[model samples]
Target: MGRVTTEPSAYHRRMAEQKRSAIIDAATGLFLDSGYDGTSLARIAEAAGVSRATLFKQFPTKAALFDAIVTEYWKVEGEGGLDLRPGDLRAGLTAVGRRYVALLTRPRMVALFRIVIAEAPRFPELGQTQFKRGKMPYFTSVRRYLEAEHEAGTVRLDDPELATTQFLGMIADYVFWPRMLLVDWSPDEASMARAVDEAVLTIEARYATSSARPA
Candidate 1:
């Protein structure tokens, strides 16, 4: 068959994505200001400037909207996935680490986390939803990257999950976890860069196979 014409569908898809983003942004702000329990879909639709019918069509329930907010917030840019070469352990992880830092440092991301922390007690499912739907995908990507590196003979990791924990935890403890407690816990670019570099070196030291080791 000849090349298919996709112009109309692509235009429609772009419009749908734009509307979805608006809905998510409106709902996220409302959830932060009003708490998940206090915010309603009608208000979110009005704030987003979309029709209530449209909002309902996109997100039929408040929980679903919250889930979308959580999932969409954590999604990495680009293809929203790790696109690392299989064997270049250091370079790949440096990219991943920088991406993680970028994710953590976004203002809306911090606010989103704060919203989850503040509202989670009364609305425990929000916490579960954030962890399950938002956080785990990113976590799993790192773990799977480690696993792939091992398979590619780039690293020798028996416990990819633990390795993932160690790698991400090191950087998060320095750059992210502190911000959760200290409102003014922003690290300088040099310091965050050092954190990522050091984490990569540590993982490489522990896990790089003999042939993968530096000459």
Candidate 2:
């Protein structure tokens, strides 16, 4: 093979990414410190050390900036795709489930959820966009994992979407609404483990074939 060379465009792309990340970091800090209504575009631009025009160019509207922040919150679990291999479907799913709970149960993400829910009535599109981009993808991935496990004779599932929903519900029942929205509770490791274990057992019980059932 001939000698490889990096393109000049790559340097510009890296600089652009760094600038965008700085803007996002500034916006997130401002949003968290001051409620959405209190934060202004000029304040964000000042915090980012960029001009208003540059900030506007990167994020045309306040809603767009908020949407980007919300998207990042949803991805706090990192990008490890769920693996449903031949061995133990329930165990594999539990590993993913624990990680998912870890994301939802984080205090920062909890605050982010509260912010989204609080502003949702004024910015309905933001809520809808987040649901489409975040929740739907997560639900679909989990459902597909269950479906594949069913096909591989590792587990059994009737209506994989419903099964996935039920599994998530088991975990979210305690963590999502009550702790994040209604109450002022902070989640700990032991509590998170208990929740994930119960969720795993519930999902496995619903999907395990007769032969695959635990004793």
Report the number of the highest-lDDT candidate. 1
Q: Tens digits of per-residue lDDT for model 2 on 1-215?
A: 99787775877888877777778778777776786777898899999888899889879988888777766666635455665464576677787788678667654666666666776787687678768766777777778778877887867666888888888888888767677545656667788789889888877777787666666
The window of 10 residues in a row where model 2 has the poorest summed lDDT is 76-85
Could you tell me which residue pairs clash in candidate 1?
A: none
Please, what is the whole-model Cα lDDT of each candidate in the order they appear?
0.89, 0.75
In candidate 1, stretches whose alpha carbon ends up further than 4 angstroms from where it belongs are 1-11
User: Candidate 1, which ten residues in sequence have the lowest lDDT sum?
Assistant: 79-88
Q: Best candidate per TM-score, number?
A: 1
Query: Candidate 1, residues 1-215: lDDT per residue as tens digits?
Result: 89987567877889989999999999889988998888999999999999999999999999998898888878899974796768788889999999999888876887788898998889899899989998799999988888899999999887899999999999988988888778888889999999999999999899898888778
User: How do all models score by TM-score?
Assistant: 0.88, 0.80
Q: Give the TM-score of candidate 1.
A: 0.88
